[model samples]
Target: MKILVVFVVMVLFCDCVMTKECTNTPTQLSSHTYRYALLNSKNKTLKQEVLTLSSHDHDHLTPTDDSAWASLLPRKVLKQEDEFSWMMMYRQMKNNNGGSGKVRDSGSFLNEVFLGDVRLDSDSIHGQAQQTNLEYLMLLDGDNLVWSFRKTAGLPTPGVAYGGWESPNQELRGHFVGHYLSATAMMWASTGNDTLKKKMTAVVSALGECQEKMGTGYLSAFPSEFFDRFEAVQPVWAPYYTIHKIMAGLVDQYVFAGNDQALKMVTQMADYFYKRVQNVITKYTIERHWRSLNEETGGMNDVMYRLYTITGNANHLLLAHLFDKPCFLGLLAIKADELSGFHANTHIPIVVGAQRRYEVTGDPLYKEIGTFFMETVNSSHS
Candidate 1:
């Protein structure tokens, strides 16, 4: 029975490649004509045919006169070899208004299944467990959850902080507050508990106050210097990872609890990171910037993509694309199973981000990355 359950989970995770169709399709009009040199003209013709058929939109097509084409096509191509042509296509899509390039039907997200629509039997074990969880969520003191945040933002700290992970000196002190917000928001939706929603809404309101005090669109238990260390490649705990949790929690509050303030706060947080990442990329090459992803970043890409779905902000979408770790994803894109030495759990969230990216943009490479990673991890690493 356990094996069967695992198999079912694997199948569902690995085969989730399709998405919803977009309503607004971009009008792709190409003006340049291709004038290929006679030498190896046949290969160029084949390449042109391949590009033309890559997508319905010609906007993703590389300019025929561009010198990059010379490097893309070798004289003799292997029949079944994948040159990762989709990478270029995705780049073009990204450049044009942050990958909102009329998503192919197969890559857009299906209609969302709201938690409010679900109901479990009251007497069932699952239902009872949910009730117990909701109760616990309410019992948690909102002041305690925001203590570190208040202190970080120089606001008056009203409640004693929790020990262990929530300790003042803990690098991951405030990560749990984000988790708490996410749980409360979800519980409110699942049970339609107005009390629970009101409590979590107050928490969101408190966090918003903390964010305003900080005045940089940044809100974290730790100092912003953590990110400075993160970008400098110095030793620091997972700052971006912690930030991802907070951002995700705010998103859940907005999505499930309908807290507009939560959305406003999270969008500000995304904007903060957008400028930060762009600065790093400007100071150094993008490849150099990717090296900073060696630390655990949790699901930064996942939350950013989720945020993009709601706000449709180009910077949010750009930030989502930036969080993708190409070194790991590039290998998975090619079906390579080199998950031996890396931390197993750290990469799972990254794969979730890839899944969300595929859902948003319908980029086949992200779909391939997600599917291949799931299959490899389940079969070999399981």
Candidate 2:
């Protein structure tokens, strides 16, 4: 009886192994076999389900008719082949247990599932990053950040180093604080580190306090006199350029980190900016004094467009329109090469603004202008 039972167990094990082997048996594909398979598969529902699941966009799937199946099947098979290749590569990566393998075909799914876990193990680059972020955090002083705003508003100055660019006699002063706030906010979001969050909160709160003290919906490291200098075409550094950076930083903080204070500060700043620019500068003035538009304004128009999207305020949209440099955009819209002597970086932002304007207004003219500018730049430069 013991021998029979042992023999029976061995037979059962062999049968199970054979069944597994049979299920996984690989078939050799010839032209005939491939064609036969495609012809034999008549289940439209099953094919539709497979296609629906594989597509990233289900609602707006390409080729929405039954005719798509004929052409789509070959593409679907190719996609499966690509996926299999990636899986084989991923398996090799797992087996090697090293971060040196290359995945040639990466998509949203592959990035999230496989490559997301892949990272350098104790490399010098990562070590330096820790030191760099630490040093950056140490350099940021919240009190000094609001020094200029405080001074202008009759509040006490904390008397720190005034930051790098925020120092006196520097036109670009206070620009660094905006960039720093933006960087810290991003760092906190990426790492979920409480220290970065604390720094961001401190900087934003200080900015808000300065805005309140000024009592004019104005918040800047410099006084509003800079705009007067800008309007007079005198030797004042790019005030709008610096302000755009700060506004963009604040907007980023709000969008990425859900910082409400940052949003409120930028909104108030936008209001002050609109009233000042609208009162002083006109459409005719912009067209006539085209050289004034050549200054490094950063993407002020882009930021205003974004603000309009967030608030649904017509004022923000109007401000965005006002920032359009007609001289630059006008020439580019006609496919003319007016960018010969222009600063590439300065004008690139304006093109970016044009693109944003196109998105917001759905104006084909803005789209044409942006496309022509981009194509011209790429063709000439590259």
Any residue pairs clashing in model 1, and if so which?
Answer: 19-106, 19-108, 20-108
Which whole-number lDDT from 0 to 100 does residue 32 have in model 2?
20
Clashes of 1: 3
Q: Show model 2 residue runs off by greater than 4 Å.
A: 1-131, 281-291
Pick the TM-score winner.
Answer: 1
lDDT (Cα, tens digit) per residue for candidate 1, span 1-382 = 6544543453354442211111112211110011112111345554454234323321111222323332233335413344445445545534653366333454235577899999999899999998888878878888888899999999999988887667787677788988998998888888898888878888888999999999999999999999987777554556887898899999999898888999999999999999999998899756446666765688999999899878867788888888887656755765666666555445678989998888777777788889898888889988
lDDT of each: 0.71, 0.62
**Which ranges of candidate 1 are over 4 A from the true structure?**
1-110
RMSD to true structure for each model, in Å = 16.9, 28.2
Q: What is the C-alpha local distance difference test score of candidate 1?
A: 0.71
Question: Residue 35 CA error for candidate 1 (Å)?
Answer: 59
- Could you tell me which 10 consecutive residues in candidate 2 have the lowest summed lDDT? 19-28
lDDT by residue (1-382, candidate 2, tens digit) is 6544543453354332211001122111111222223223465554344223322111111222233212323453346545455344334422431212211121322223322233333356874685578567756677867677677677788856474356655566777777777677666655566777777787788778888988998877778898876665443556787898889889878876888988998999999988877766564343323334434577888999888778777788777766766555655554556565455555678889988776666555667878888788788865
lDDT of 2 at 175: 75
TM-score, per-candidate, Cα-based: 0.75, 0.64
